[model samples]
Target: MKTTCKSLLLYVLIASVAVNAFDPFTATFVVGVGAALGRWIYEYSQEKCDSKWIAFNATGLETDLERRLFGQHIASRIILKAVTGFMKNDNPKKPLVLSLHGWTGTGKNFVSQMIAENIYKEGMESSFVHVFTSELHFPHPSQLETYKTQLQQWVKGNVTNCAQSMFIFDEMDKMHPGLIDSIKPYLDYYDKLDGVSYRKAIFIFLSNAGGESITQTALDFWSAGRDREEIELRDLEVALSLSVFNNKKSGLWHTSLIDKNLVDFFVPFLPLEHKHVVLCALAEMEAKGLQRNLDVADRVARDLVYFPKPERVFSVKGCKTIDSKLDYYT
Candidate 1:
């Protein structure tokens, strides 16, 4: 009984000391120290942990893009499957898929993310997948040769021998023909080095050249004292039929790079159809409070519809329609 009373007295004294030590500065310091310690522990644990944030899940994404593009989900699934297959086989001998985007579209970021997410959904990590993006910019005359040399080095280092890598070129139209020529050797290297036993890596080049340019030309022609509606419809049809990239030398129109015969897959952008799908997707994201700069989409859509009068069309509030219900058209 005496020992128990002594223990109670000791606890009461400690509690009294703690309660008396109530200086604001001391409390703040204690809290700050605790917060710092907690942060340090969390960071340490994260560094030591092997788990990663999964960016894509097939089951989850099925509902995502499906609400955006109805039947195109089939194509998206195929793309996801193809990339996953490439990841599963450790053999670098698999064919790589190159997805190219048209002018104003950042194919590298968008397509690469989509592909990356799809691969991740299949339980693959970003480090295990190789997605390369080549952006062709018109370099200054003085820096052209140096840039070329650096580009060659980069290709050799990152892209040369990888058996399964996707090379995506954003804004194919902006890519100078000379720049495309420069990369021809790398594509050839991949092709020649790939044996028949190696899984074929696929290349996909997507472009919107045909639709945008044709629509612009038609709008220019129709702007001169002609029936606007008829001209608009005609321009739309022409834009729809316009090829993404036209071979200036051969008169053959293609949406993707043509100098390299090794490119196995070419995807042309159907302006009206592709634009509609993308816009709908953007609208859905916007509705969900996902931030996106719709200005780019607006500009691209206007360029497709009233090529010559893009500025005028954009200025009109109701002229450009996003969805069947959301009209940006003035």
Candidate 2:
């Protein structure tokens, strides 16, 4: 009844203006256009939390991670299980918090991108997927207090808007220590803070904080003549977390997030070997819609610097410069 009366009043108002503003045909056209514009604005501004916008394809994520992401089998597996399990749950106790630690170009950012692409229809372009770079977003140390307040509000407001929202913090190694603690409340086991449940949200922290420890473990395996793929999460998680906590340079220096067991996983992205770099080059070519050129890919991979003096087992920067390097080679 209320809806019908509203429609009648709206129609009457339009009819009232039909004479002075426009002819009958013109008035109808104007009203139609106005309605369409209003609807378009609403659709454009609001992102729906329906299946159309948010759907997790676990198989797709696993397959892509296996195909597109090279090396670091442990990181890939942990990501798949942790994310898949969390999304599958109807009611989670706390937000899924993952701290991805690795050296540059070893696929920390790449893995994060893959996760977003699988969950959100718009991928990295989705409004619900928020990315904050420590250096770019919160550079000034003197503003630690201000950054904390703003950071808390940002997470709270975004999660309120969409519970399944993904927040990625890039370059966490450079982030001020206490700044992250501001949002610690959101990562806790609480059902809700201020009547808003953050349990469904996702928080990812990327950093080079524990790269040394991870690399050392991989190097040790190589020294023992074991396959790099044989390296497991059990081999690295403990040392990695400890190193990240102790390292003064790492943004997570003695953070309560780790102390209180808030971070669910300290995923270690191992250094990329020569073969992995070659795979990266080939994948880049495929992504660019180019024909698979093994020779070009080989050259591109070989051109990069590798480590450990004579052995040169791992690519120093992994696939970090693969895209531009491919452009130069091809």
TM-score per candidate, in order? 0.46, 0.89
User: RMSD to native for every prediction?
Assistant: 12.7, 6.2
Angstrom error at residue 258, model 2: 1.4
Q: Candidate 1 on 1-330: residue-level lDDT in tens?
A: 346545555654454456547787776665565556556555643412122433335544454445433323223454555555545555644355443322332122344555545534332244334333334344354565666676556545443344333344444444444554554455543435333222433344444345345335434544564533233323343343335334431112442335444443332221223345346546544765656656645554454433224334211211224443233321
- Best lDDT goes to which candidate? 2
Off by over 4 Å in 1: 1-64, 69-78, 92-95, 101-109, 120-137, 141-143, 158-167, 188-206, 212-260, 273-330
Candidate 2 Cα RMSD (Å)? 6.2
Q: TM-score of model 2 relative to the true fold? A: 0.89
Q: What is each predicted model's overall lDDT from 0 to 1?
A: 0.42, 0.89
- Against the true structure, whose TM-score is highest? 2
